[model samples]
Target: MAKHYALASYADGGDWRETEHLYVPRRDTRLRLQSLMALGYTASEVAAATGLSPSHVCNLRTDVVHTTVHVFTADAVASAFRDRWDKLATGPQANRQRSKARRLGYLLPLEWEPGDVDTDDTTEMFLSDPSSPETTENPEVLDYVAIAEAIAGRRVTLTRAELSHAIVTLQDMGVGVHETAERLHTYTRLVNRYRARARQDAA
Candidate 1:
């Protein structure tokens, strides 16, 4: 269910505008955190993004509100969520997983060995062939703030947060939360998710 409100939102000079439909904090922070994870946030990142601790996020998974949710301050959660809210701009990761789930795949190149990519070093190739007559770049990424914003987009958003929280209503379904990224260069899946999602959403 949606939590909505009609408030006399004021303008700079005191002009009032009515707005409706707001999000409510159900006793379900854990479910929301799970959704945020699927959206590509690491546990620590989600905590940073949502302004809660990893333990608190863990508790949300269990709906252990008596121990976790109540201790979270409103300002902290709001700040964390807002930081991630702007991350909402990010659509998906750069590289997508192969359909029919490959048993194995080529490792990314770190350096050129006689023009052949050497994936031994495990360095990521964040570069994309933008002018390859295939992909488009975000206009904001050309500058510093946009790049930072793009990084933040890998977090979560209010919409995702709401969807995450809604899992509690899913007949008490379990939302498994895990973090697989520890090496910075391992964001291939995330980058692909962003790229694919961006492409589809744009279309």
Candidate 2:
């Protein structure tokens, strides 16, 4: 049996039906999707987890033009993100996804906090230009131990902070700038820039 409900009347005597479809700003949803990819989860994997189509997941992750997303879609993605945020995906596809995300400068899962995920300030931080003078002035902290551990791994993937720290550490150990660049598999100019910054900080 189908039941019909009467619409509530406003003070002016006009009746309106309640809306079932809801939408929300897509910023946080996009970030969550991107973070999942950065953690090595491919679009298909995320789609499988969320029951969303792979194309839909990819669109949401890459399309900044869309300002809003359906509420249910956002909820599904949020659920998947909560479940997989700290877990790194495996396999060749996952490695490809991580490489793509890294090339796009997406933030890693551990780089964001639960409280900061929905904030515009945090989003701006991720989107800011890394080569800007302001960015060069206030660099991320150096962690030599973390850099060493990453270097020791079979698959090496170091963040910009870690790379900078490695260059500085190598230079401090009397390694030539060219040799440091070769060891880190980066450009000589970059090694020089980082070394220059380290010297400036020391001064």
Top TM-score model: 2
lDDT of 1 by residue, 69-169 (tens): 33234224433433342132122431222111122221222111232312211111222332222234443334443323323333322222222122222
TM-score of 1: 0.29
- Provide the global lDDT of candidate 1 against the true structure: 0.33
Candidates in order have lDDT scores of 0.33, 0.67
TM-score of each: 0.29, 0.48
Residue range 1-203, candidate 2, lDDT tens digits? 34333222211133433435466788888988998898789888899988899999999998989899876677678667755653467657987887899899897754665555564433433434434453343344555566786444322456556767777778778888767755665446567766776777789
lDDT for 10 in candidate 2 is 17
